[model samples]
Structures are given as structure tokens and as C-alpha cells.
Target: MNAMRLRALLLASLLALGAFAQAPARGGALPPPLPLFPLDNWWNADITHAPVDPNSAAFITYLGAGRGMHPDFGGDSGDPSAPIYGMPYVIVASSQPLVPVTFDYDDESDYAAPGRTPGYPIPNEAKSQQRWIEGGLAGGDADADGDRHMLIVDRDLRILYELYALHWTGSRWEAGSGAIFPLDSNARRPDGWTSADAAGLAILPGLIRYDEVYGPDPIRHAFRVTVRHTNGYVFPASHRAGNTSGALPMGARLRLKASVDLSRFPEPMRKIFQAMKTYGLLVADNGTDLYVTGTYDTRWDNDVLNPAFGAIKGSDFEVVQLGWQPSRSDNRRRSVRH
Candidate 1:
């Protein structure tokens, strides 16, 4: 073929290929949806878009008449200028990536708590089958904070594994709690039960990723935060009494009050705050008041992220309408996904 004609034909083919590569699904529809849980899980199922809990007003009133809200996330990690700067994030990378691991545990471990195993060179997975070889144990304590939550996602396998207080004693992986979760479900921890996290909730479900801020997708779920006090439990929350108290019970879901103003914040911060307003936060553990959870990424600039929510306060949040589901039977999920 003539050189000019050949060049023109090649250019036309390339243009067509580029458009096809970026095209939407058939009928111009969006891609298939991701599940609501696990590492790949975004906030698509977040309560913000869900119907308002009919009992939100009463729950807020019960928490207190004059209670103020706080932002657990913001400012910089270890920077004085940041409001919630003291908290750190744990970044996963150590050990074998995307592989399950076996560990030795104390009497408190879920495997031991159930009381099924006897002496063994390796503990059995009859009860804890999912724990052995889940995620890579090589995670860093980003904020230098002791929470040491480890999250590993096997993207190829479409699975997410989580652990709390995870540590490698140079021999075996030990942790305060551990859980195996399928990335494809809206499932909560079984009612009146617990997972690797104290709140019986999966840790990855609530954490904010840096990409979520930079990407088109909105964070679709609630943020997991801690508080020193809570009354009882709530629904979507499967467990109760992570050691119980006059304070809140395990699985309590609290949302950012809708009335709060988010207009002044920047785009990224506004997205997060808007999520708080709509989806609110879940009480996953006992800690300082209103500390929300997020992952570690070096790309974050403390200067920008910290000041984004500077004007927000904790009292601005209100308890949303969610009641505790006390029994496994009461909150039994027939399948992983509803």
C-alpha cells in the first residue's frame, strides 16, 4: 500500500481502539457494582443515601442533650497543626502478600475463646479456618499509634482479611483479634458475636483510602470511630458489649447530623464530611471521643488534609436511628449478601 494511505489507515484504527478501551458497558451503562464489604468495598452502600433511621432523633437525645461532635480524622499525622493529628494509620505490606497465615494465640483469641482445639503443633482451623494464610503480616504502624490494625486485600482472589493489634513475634503472627471477610457481602459480624476487631466489625469496611478522595467514587459506607461512652447497641451492628458499660455498646452506628454545614470545606474534605452527615460514623471500639478511621498513604499532605475540616467539631454529630440486635438469631444473616 502507498505510505500515505497506510499511515491514515493506522491512525483511524488507533482512534477507534482508544474509544473502545474507555467506553462504558453495553447500552452505555456503568460497570458491574462492587460489594459493600472487604478492602475493595467502597461506600456505595453507605447509610447517607439510605433512608433516615426513623429513630435518629430519639437516639441523639438519649446520647445527651448538649453533646458536641468531634472529627477523629484531620490535620497531619504527628503534626501539631492537625486537630486529630495524633492518630496514626497502619500500612500493610510485610509477610507473604495475599496469603493466609497461621498464628499462636492466648486464651482470648477467637479460636481459643470458642474452646475446640486441644494441644497441637499447629492450631486447627475447624473454627478459625479463614485466619490461617489470609493477608500478608507485613504492615507498618503508620502513626506510630499502637492500634496496629492490619488490612490486606487479595485483589486477584477478591478477598479482604483484617486483624487488630497484629504483631509478628518473629515466630508466628499474633493479634488481639482476627477476622476473614468476603469482599462480596453487606454482611455484619454475626449477632452478639465478634471478629478480629473489638467492635465485631470488619476494619476495612470503614477506612478512608487516599484514592477515594482523588477518584470519582464517593466513600459509600460509614466511618468507624471510637468513643469513651455509649448506651447500648444498634442494628447493621451485629455485636453488643465490647466489654459493655454505661457507655455505648458494640456496633452502635452514629451519623453526622444532616443539619451541619459542609459548604465551606474543600472538595475532598467536603466529600468526607458529607459522608459523615449522611452515613455518619459507627462506634467500633472504646477510645477517645469521635476518632474516625483511615488508611495510610504517603501521598497525603498534612497541610491540606489537616485544615480541610478545621472548623468542624464533634458535638455537631447526632446519633442516628439504629437499635441493638442482641441475639444471633435476632440478627442472623441468611447469606453473605442480603
Candidate 2:
């Protein structure tokens, strides 16, 4: 073949390969038509009309009602090599290999007998790919710190595996804690058990995935949130990581007041705020109050997110009655896109 034609063909092949690598279905973040769990699950419950906690005022005050909401996620830090801030998750097939993870809190983690074998399904590529695990680093990087949460979903098995403070010991995986959940069920962890999250809740369900925020459908589930302090845990939350007096519980729900005006914000931000009004935010962990978590994606522009989220203050939200669940007859939603 002519030299020019050979070069052109090579370029075309590279472009096609890039496109395939980026396809959502191949191994992207969560795919569309979501609510990872069943609609009736607490993550998908419609709490817009749920009664507010009588201590809502106190809770709001404790969380600093004057503070504006913060989007705890965004794109790269100018440098393409930097990891974005947010909890990231991966979708794997049933064939994804199950690797044994040694847990710091072994009693609370899921594992096989004898040697406490690693049974969590993780993609092999996570060994070297950033953004596969939380903190956006490859699983084997020992230098990576922070929560370092790792969430993996076996789509074919409809199961979720989440690890907290996850790290690779060069020889094996070690974590602070880990939990597995059947996506199709509403099962809760054993009482007082701490999962990958302090609340013993599924992290993916509560994350504000990029696709769901920008997709055609409205967000249908509660977003995960963090608070500076928590007193205990409520129903949906099976574990307690804090005991600060007068603070909100781990499972506390904070709903954006219907009175909050979302019209002034851009469409995407407005939709997020609207979901806050509808499903509310689930306090899944202890961190900065009103900091909402989402997926790590380069598409996210912090410049747009920062000021937009800052517009809504803590005062605009009210704490829903703790442990409140919608009526069984209330079939009001679908799966969480995360």
C-alpha cells in the first residue's frame, strides 16, 4: 500500500480503538436506567413528603446552617495526572476475578473461612489504572491515602463489593473494612456492623454519578453526604462511627426545603437540587457537613460546580425524621443509577 494510505489506516484504527475504550458499556461508570437497588429500598425511597425531625433546627444548627453546600467531587486538578475528588466505582462482569482482601476489621468484613480468603470481585485492570478505585489511584499504589474506598459491581451477579481505606500490600489487598450486597435485595448489615462505609450502607447507591446527573431521566435516589460529626446511627445505618453529643446520626436524612428556589441555577445543578428536595441526602459518613459525594470524572468542571453548589446553604434543608421509611404501598421509584 502507498505510504500515505498506510498512515491514514493506522490513524483510523487508533481512533476506533480509543472510541471503544471510552464506551460506557465496555467498562465505564454506572450505565443508565439506575437506582442500583430496588425502588422501595431506602436509597430510592421518596421522602419529599416525609415528616421532618422535631430536632431539625438543632441538627441544622449543628451542621452550620449558614454554610453553603459543597460538591465533594470534580474534574482533574489542571494536571491530567491528578486524581479528581470523589468516590469512584467500577462495573465488572461476573467473570471478573474475585480477589481475597485481608481486612483490618476482619470480624466485620465478608470473607471465606480457613484463611479468610479474598472473595471480592475486582477488575484486573485496577492494578494499574487510576480512577478504578476511590482516591482515583490504581489499587496497588501504597502511597495513596485518604478514604481510598474501592467499589466494584458485578453486573451479571447483581452484587456490590465495597472496601474502605483499601490498599494493596504488594502481596495482597488490605482494607479497613469491606461489605458485599445483593443489588436486587434490601438486606441490611447485621446490627452494629460497619461496612465499607460507617453507616454500613452501599456507597454506590448514594453516590451522585455523572451519567445520572446529565442523563435524560431525573435523579431518583438520595445522594450520599458527609457530616463533621454523628452521634450514633439510625435504622438504615447499622453501625456508628461517632458519638458526639447532639449531632446528627449516621442515617439521618436532610431534605432540601421545597421553598428553596432552584430556578436561578443551571439545569444540571437545578436537577441535583431538585433531587435533594425529592429524595434528600443520606448521611453516610463523617466528613465536612453538607459535602455531597459523586463519581470521579474529567467531564466535571469545578468552576461551574463550586459556585453553583455554594448557592444552597444548610438552612435550606431540614432533617427528615430518623429511620423514616415510605409506606410499603408507595411504589414511587426505580433503581439508583450509581
Candidate 3:
């Protein structure tokens, strides 16, 4: 072949290879559309810094103590009328089993009340689980100030999560607006999968779904799980700014660490996770007051994931209508209506 022709052919081959590598993966048949939970208004009061108030009391009551029996034991509380504000509960990693750790604002006198039992027991099975290899306190205590913090340990006995329920005290925003905190540290697992890695992998995709300016938003809710990749390369632009409309960039790759176990999941979940080998992320944004997003790609039907993840129907996971902007006056009127 002529030199010019040979060079042209080589260039063309490289371009084709690049295009093929970048193309979106197509399975034999696309998996059935996953179910979603939708969010309500996106512009509520910035409760992140709001203070504890009557509303905060009610919110905590609903989440912590429950309506009657069968209370959701995950909240930290501060008052009796369910007034004032604090996390209803916090989970900390503990080496010892069965004894509940208390994190209250009132001193030891408060815990010494007549009928108040101070601690709870850890399950025997949980003690034998491999995740709690290095268990620690899963609860918290108040600091010099009255603000309360909560802690949680992952199955691996690692102190992987912490939550600071209400920190701002005696302020109007102090009731509902303390920081909902998370851990800043990272730990390495034997098979990869550090805590930070899991959180990043689980949360990033949902962040992408919410922030992406293009087409209809894919998420209905904000609660989600992100799986991390050990060998993947994040797109420079996507990392700095965000992803563009339609699809991801050409060289984007999400690599996973070795320790994730996907053995007993349903067929659909398995298929989705395997396919994620190519895409590396799966996001579900059910529309509601709560939002969930994550990094791991699993194929369970919407039925399974929603219940397991505390996602509600209709409001918990529904797609957001993009490009439908209301006028300022209209928004003001809508706010009044609410």
C-alpha cells in the first residue's frame, strides 16, 4: 500500500476502536425499568442549619419513637413531649455485645430515672458476624454544649458512620437545623472496599442524577448507594464540574474494589451489577421528601430495593420533570399555597 494510504487507514482504525470502546453497553434485553421513589419540593427551608423547634420535635418523634410500638430505634432524642431537638438514635461500633450506650444531654441523673432502662443488648448472631471484627460504641454523648452526636458501625466492626443530629443550640434554627453529619475518615478492608470508597461510590451517581442539567432527571428520590471502583478513572470535567447531557464522556471508567459480595442477590440485581462492570454505577432517585443514591450496581426489582432501602412509593421515587421552570411570581404563589 502507498505510505499516505497506510497512514490514513491506521488513523481510521484507531478512531473506530475508540468509538466502539466508548459506546454504551447493550445487553441482550434491557432490564425491566426499576421502580423509583420521588421527592416533593426541592426548595424547602434549608433545614441543614435550622434550629430545633416544635416542628423539629414532631419530626424527631415521628422518626425515633414511632406512632406507638415498633419504634424505629435509630433516632436520638432530647426531651419528653418529643419537644426540643436531637437525633432519635445513633449506632456506634462496639466490641462488647448487648449493652446500650446512652448519649443524652441531661447528666447521669436523667438516665437514673425510675423506669428508664439505659441500655439494650446486641444480638448473639450479630456478634458472630464477620463485619463487627473491631466493634466500638455505636452511640454518642453530648459535648460541653447540649448538642448530641450519634455513631454507627458497619458490619465489618469498623467505625464507618457518624451523625451530628442538632448542634446549633438555643437558636430558632437550632431545632431542625443542626448538621446531619457523616464520617470524614476512610478505612481499608481486606478485599478493598473502604468506608469512604463505599460512601463515595454509593452517593456520587445520585449527585450526578440530581445535578445533571440535561434531559429529565433519572432519580425520584435522593437516597442511593454508590459502589467504588479500584481501577477506574473519573472524567476530569465530570469530577470538577459535572456530566453533560445525554451520556457520559468517552473514557470514563468506574473500577470496583475486590471485597463486594453479590452471590445471593436476585437475577435482575445480579445482571445489573454485572452490567455495571461496563458502566460502574447505578442510581435510583425515587421522588419524595427523602432522596437516596448509591454507587453499586445491583439488579433487584424495585419492589425489593425500595422496601430494603426505606424508600416510599409514589413520593419516594419518581423522575423530576426537567426544563419546566415556573416564573418567580408563580413560585411565590405556590409557596403560599403550601
Candidate 4:
């Protein structure tokens, strides 16, 4: 390689090492600036910037923030009806075994423009959910169409799998759409490519998780939020708003208040609260205001986190990067061509 390239790599290596050495001992550690899917691809490269439009004031006026951040995943597995709002995710460790699984897709499939044939192998097993599926009917959003979601995180593969309109036929997995994303890569669906998610975005990357909370790592990217209405969308968003009466759009981004103090919470919970200030949250789907989605794990103590969220309300959030660019603003085909 050229001398300049080699020098840049060396400099980056030193900086990373320096940051590692300086990690604070008392509180949760800071996450690396760039996150990769498995080991090399950048996952959250686009979300780290501050909001472009600074429309938090307008958003607060229209779509209220509702309540402080709440933990959707946690606690003993006994509670049948908890983690209210929308769908949750499933986490699988790298060491866990991969099983013979299948994926079924329809109109929403990113694999196909008109949507390709279904019945692709996903390699999942029953043990996969200890988190299980969120049984019962799916919510009535046009995008979700009563199809409950199945979002999986394979920590070992560092790969993320998302399936929509999912239903288990007693023996295997069945869903409307499916997309696999490598956590290491910065790649997104081709401009307007739709994934299993309503926004055509990968679900796992935008979720809240127990490990990211309790461990030294902070959530690097924004968490996916559901809202009742929207005005338009922003770049990196592959779909248009299903409804336009609201103030915010499909891809509108929201950042947590930098002034919101996190020092009072426990170390684990502190990382999540701090993420709100740093990574912020993204508007992904339709649901209750400020409801951030996450994976299902018994370790999460929703009761413990419910009260801590009282500190901040919807007014504390800012709408970063408003969905402008005349072509993308209107509800036409979600592409630059208009």
C-alpha cells in the first residue's frame, strides 16, 4: 500500500488503543465511534451526526415525546403481558447452534423488486426464543398488517435477521418479508429497498438490548421508535410515509436531550440513558409516542426501568435531519427520481 494510507492506518490504530486505555473505571464505558456488523463492516456510520434541521421545537409541538425512555426488554420470564407497545427482538449468542430454518416473504421482501419467491432457509431453532414470539394478533398498522414481527440478533455471526408478518406453523418459521444484515457492514438497502421492517430498515440495529445496557458498551446507533403520525422522511430511509397528516415523517430522526443527566442511574442503565444523549432515537414505525422497540430477554427488569424514565418527557427530544429534498418529501415512489 501507499505510504500515506499506511500512515493513516497506523494513526487510527494508536487512537483506538488510546481510547481503550482511557475508559472510565466507575461508570459505563463509551462505545467506539464506528460500529461494525460482524468485524469489519460499518453499521451506524450515518446516524452519528447531529440533526440537520433542528426542528425539535416543531416536533415537540406536534408529536409530543410522550414519556421518558423505557426498557422494553428485561426481568424474569414469568410476566405474560409486559413490554407493552410494539414488537420486541430475540438475541442469540455466537456460540449458540444454528438450526435448519425457513423464511417466507411476500410484497415487502427486499430480496425482490416485485418481491421474489418465498421459502428461503434462515437456520433458526426453537431454543431461539426463550424469548419466544409475541403471540396474539399483530397491530393494525398498514405496514405491519397484523403480522407480528420476528427480529433476531445472532451475536456469534454478528448478523441481524428480521421477518415481518411472522407466524410459526407449529414446526417452522413463516413470515411475510425477511432481510439479513451483517453488523459489520455500513451497507443499507439500496436507496428505497424495503426490508422486513416497515421503514425498510433493519430492526436489530435500532433496538435496545440488555448487553448494550449492562456492559461497558453504549448503544452506538439510534433506537427505532413508533409514532402515530409523520410529515415526511429523511435520507437513508428507504420508504415513504404511509400517512402524511402528522408533523413528523417516516424517517424523521430524534436526538435525546444532551442536558439530561444520567449519573444518578445504575451503571448498566446509565449506558442506555447516555445513548439517548449521544446516539439519540430514530422514527421507524407507527405505534404509541416515544415507544422504542427492543429484544425480549428475561434478564430485563421493566419495573426497575419504568420509573427511571420519568426524569425526561417528550419535550426533551430534538428532531434532527428533517426529511426535506423535495423529491423525497412527497409520498411518491421513495426514490431520488421522483
Candidate 5:
């Protein structure tokens, strides 16, 4: 072949390879940042008692916040600093086992509670709520104590969302019916604030919506939810907003540090983590009360050691870095982006 022809052919091959490398395999615009929070500072807080005003945008922000899981780093077993603040507020109202709830994404009915067996007449309440009694529903028998429910509301006291478990008596599946509960009353703040003072601050989702980005592949992403309840401490709400001027409402103004061991995840999730090549952080405006976000990244081949089960050499997972800055404006609920 002529020298010029050979050069042109080589260049074309290089360009094609670059395009292939940049294309996303199957997932959509990098899965919206997983709901990952911080591990230190504030760990848990309850906003169930906080009044939610349906008329205000804050109310919508609050509802959006309950959409994902808030993870944490170091504290007591249930509470951590990276996620939300308020320990008593972090209620898990699942009738199903935590293991199965977190691991078994395949069995849509695995999280359902055992219902009345054959021969026993369904209770009147169960019959009246036939939709909930059916199988394949998100709702189920809540924990016996009833402490698992957490309510998300706007500043106007409007109930935005409810997080709880459910039980199934009949044999059908649905998404809405379940055992719902509210957070303990002690975690909320006294109401009475204008929309302007709370501008830029909003509620963020707790669960990182992975299916939107990762597709059907099962990958476990670790995150932290930190809630800082300033009941006694007072700061200018306007000042908070001033500090975060010109940033995304749910962006991170502060950076935090965290680490995860891919080996901790089971089978497919573990394998998916191994295949990752890059990752990024995503945060949502849960409510004007707290900041929630998570990390989504490609796994480096070297960080794939299964230390929990046995030592296997892989990559040393990078220590996640984070930061937090006090906003200048009194807008106590400033949404920050990194």
C-alpha cells in the first residue's frame, strides 16, 4: 500500500477506538450520584415533627429526599457521621430481614411479610385493605416496635413522604401499599420561617437511585447520611444561603473522607464493583433540613481485595475526600454542590 494510504488507515483505526472507549456500555448518563453521606460529624436526626408547607418549593424538595439510602462512616452501629444527623430518627421499619432487603433485589416479594395462612379468615382490617394484603408490594409488616417509620415533611407541615415497611396477606404485587410510620417527635425543629430564608436549601433523597444509571446490574455502592440537628444552636439562616451563592442546590460545599471495601459485597455486586473504572459524587437536596449525597465510580482493578472473607490483592480503594463550609447568608437551608 502507498505510504499516505497506510497513514490514513492507521489514523482511522485510532479514532474509532477512542469513540468506543468514550461510549457508555448500557447505563444512562452516569447513574445519578448514589445516595452516599459522611461518616463522622453528625450521624442522625429526625424531621418528622418539622412542619412541611405544601405551598412552598421546600415541600417538594423534602419529598425528593426520601428517594434513596443515606449511608454513614463511623459512630454507633445505627448512626454515623457521613449520613444524616439524629440517631433516633434513623428508623428501619422493615418486617423483612435487613440482609434480604439489602441483598435480594431479584425476589420482588422477598421483602414482604408473612401473612395469614390458609384456613384462617383474613382479618376485617386486612380485607378492607386488600390492595396492601396482596403480594409483590413495597409495604409490609413494620417492625414490631413501630419505630421504623420516618416522615418527610415541608416547612408548612405538609407531609411529603413516608418511609416504612409492609406485610402481605393476599397473593399479588403492588408498589404503594405498606406499613408506614413516622419518626420520633424529639428530632424535629419548631416551625415558622419564610421561603426566602430557606431558599437554596432543600431536602435530599436518602437512597441513591442506581437503576437510573447502572441499569439492571446489581452493584453495591457504599454511602453515608449525616443529619445535623441544630435545635439549641442558632445561626443566621440568611448567612447560610450567602455562603453557597452560585452553586447547585444539592451540591457539596464541604468535602468529607470515607472508604469502602469492595470485598464486603456479595457475588454479582462484588464483580460489578471490580469492573468499575471511574466514579463521581452525587448529592440531592433532601429537604431544607439536611444534605444527602452518594458516590458513583468505576472500580480500580487493584482495589478488589476480599479482606472480610480472605485477603486477596487488588487495588487499595481511594479514601473518599469531602468538605463542609458554613454558608455566608442566613439561609439556614442552603443547597451546596461540590
Candidate 6:
């Protein structure tokens, strides 16, 4: 072939390689940010106009109105081996092997359920990958008291598996409780059933993912939040983790008051606060008051994240009415996108 023809062929080959490199990973690699569940799902609901609970003031007081909003995720501490300050998740393909998971709360867990594939789609790497669980304990440290949450997404099957207090035995996997969620549907856990989260809610939907936080689009869903105390759970939250009178319940939604100004914050931080105004926060567990959960990512700068979130206090939020739902007409209007 002529030299000119050979050059053209080489360029074509390079172009093809570039396209392949840009393509998404084939073995269940994460796709670009999309709606986790349906748009009408509670997590994605537009609750800006939702009714404020009559007990909003009392609940906020119980949760310490003066307490600041805390970002419970970000860059590492000095120790490289210590688990990062956020929950971690993994994605797997449909062909990923499913393993039987023994659960302490077997009745509530979905193990061997009809719709679910016989076992959890937990990857083998979870046994060796330190980042698979909350505490960053890989195959060792089976007795840690931390929540040890393990969240796995089956990208091809559109399924979510979440395990609370997960531990790996030399021969098998065990957990305190396990829950499976269908990502494409908005189904709640059976009434009074606890999932991987205390609220019986899907943890992935409410978490602030790294990609979503730094992406071009705004975060369009509610965030998973924690409080020092909770009284029974309300609608959308399937289980009640506590009964502290006058305290907020699991599944309670807190909207950032519109009056809270974002002008002084940087653009990225502003998008986060803006999401609070729109989708609000859902109380999912018992922990420090006003702490929000996010995925583990080293790219996070806690120095910037900490102060920015700390500026807002619990008083800046209002609790929505218990079991609030958009009107039929409103749902129809907002149902256009996921």
C-alpha cells in the first residue's frame, strides 16, 4: 500500500480504539447519573411545596435546632488503611455469581425470595476488597461493631442488594439483615420490614454519590440523613427503629427553608444545598443529628465540604407532614421524567 494509504489506515485504527476506550465498562460498570428509582418515587419527589408537619418545631427542637448540618463523607484521614468516612458500594453484571447470605433477621430479609435470584449478587472481591463495606474491613475484623453496610447494584438486572452489619466468615457470608430492591420500581419493603437501613428504605437511592455531586446535572433526589434519636417510623419508612416521643421518625423529610441563602457558598456546594431545598432529607438511621451520608471517594475535599455544610443548622430545615404525598394532578405533572 502507498504511504498515504497506510497513514490513513493507522488513523482509522486509532479512532476505533478511542471510541472503545470511551465506552462504558462491559461487566456492570456504572452508567452516567440517571434517576435511581422512578421520578414519582419518594426519593425523587419535588417536595418544595409539601406541607410542613404540625409538629415540625417540636421535632427540630428535639433534634437540637442549633446542631449544624454535617457532611458525613469526604477525603481520607492520615491513615491510608483506615476506611474512608463514607459508605461504599459496588456494581456487578447479571452473570455475577450469587451467594447465599445467612441473616440474623431472617424473617425480614429477602434471602431465597421468589422474585429475587436465589442469592445475593455479592462479588468475590468483597472478601478481599477493603472498600466494599462501611468500615473498610475486607476479609478480616469480623467482629467490628460498625454498621458494616454493603450495597451492591446489579447493573444489568437493575437490582439493588443491601446488607447491614455484614461480615464474611471464612466459609460464607452473614449479616444482621438484608434487603433487596428493584431499581426500576418504587416498591417499599413489606410494612414494618427493616431493610439494610433502619428505615427499611433503599440506601442507594438516598445516598449522595460522587459522580452526581461533581457532575454537570444537579442532584435531583433526597439524601439519606441520620439523627441522634427517632420516634416510630412514618410512611415510606417500613420499620420503626425507635419510639422517642416528640422526636422525628424514620422516613421523616426535612426541607431546607427557601429563605436560607446560598449566594455566599461556592457553586458545587450550592448545588448540594439547592438539592436539599428541592428533594429534602430523609431520616434513615440513628446517628449524630443532621449528618448526611455519601459514597466513599478520595476526590472529596472535606476541608471545603465540612465548613460549607456546617454553616447550615438543623433550624434551617422544616419537617414535612407525616405521610405527605403530592396530589393526583401534581403527580401526573411531575411524572414526565425519571
- Measured with C-alpha atoms, the lDDT of residue 67 in candidate 5 is 32
Judge candidate 5 against the unseen true structure and give its global Cα lDDT, from 0 to 1. 0.25
TM-score of 1: 0.61
Error of 2 at 119 (Å): 1.0
Residue 50 lDDT, candidate 2, scale 0-100: 93
- Candidates 1 and 5 compared: the better one by lDDT is 1
Q: What TM-score goes with each of the models?
A: 0.61, 0.88, 0.19, 0.66, 0.22, 0.89
Number of backbone clashes in candidate 2:
8
RMSD of each: 11.0, 4.9, 25.9, 12.9, 20.4, 4.5
Tens-place lDDT per residue, model 3, 83-196, is 222122223333333233233321211111123243322223222221111111111112323322222222223222322222212221111111111122221122211111
Residues 107-213, model 4: lDDT tens digits: 44544212223233232432233223443223222232354666555544456666776655556555666777655565666655567766667776676766566
Minimum summed lDDT over a 10-residue window in model 3 is located at 172-181
Clash numbers, per candidate: 32, 8, 91, 22, 101, 0
Give the C-alpha miss distance for residue 312 in model 4, angstroms: 1.4
Better of 3 and 6 by TM-score: 6
lDDT of 2: 0.83
Which candidate order results from sorting by TM-score in descending order?
A: 6, 2, 4, 1, 5, 3
What is the Å distance of residue 337 in model 4 from its true position?
37
Locate the minimum summed-lDDT window of 10 residues in model 6: 23-32
Q: What value does the lDDT take at residue 227 in candidate 3? A: 15
For candidate 1, what is the lDDT? 0.50
Model 2 residue 301 CA deviation (Å) reads 1.1
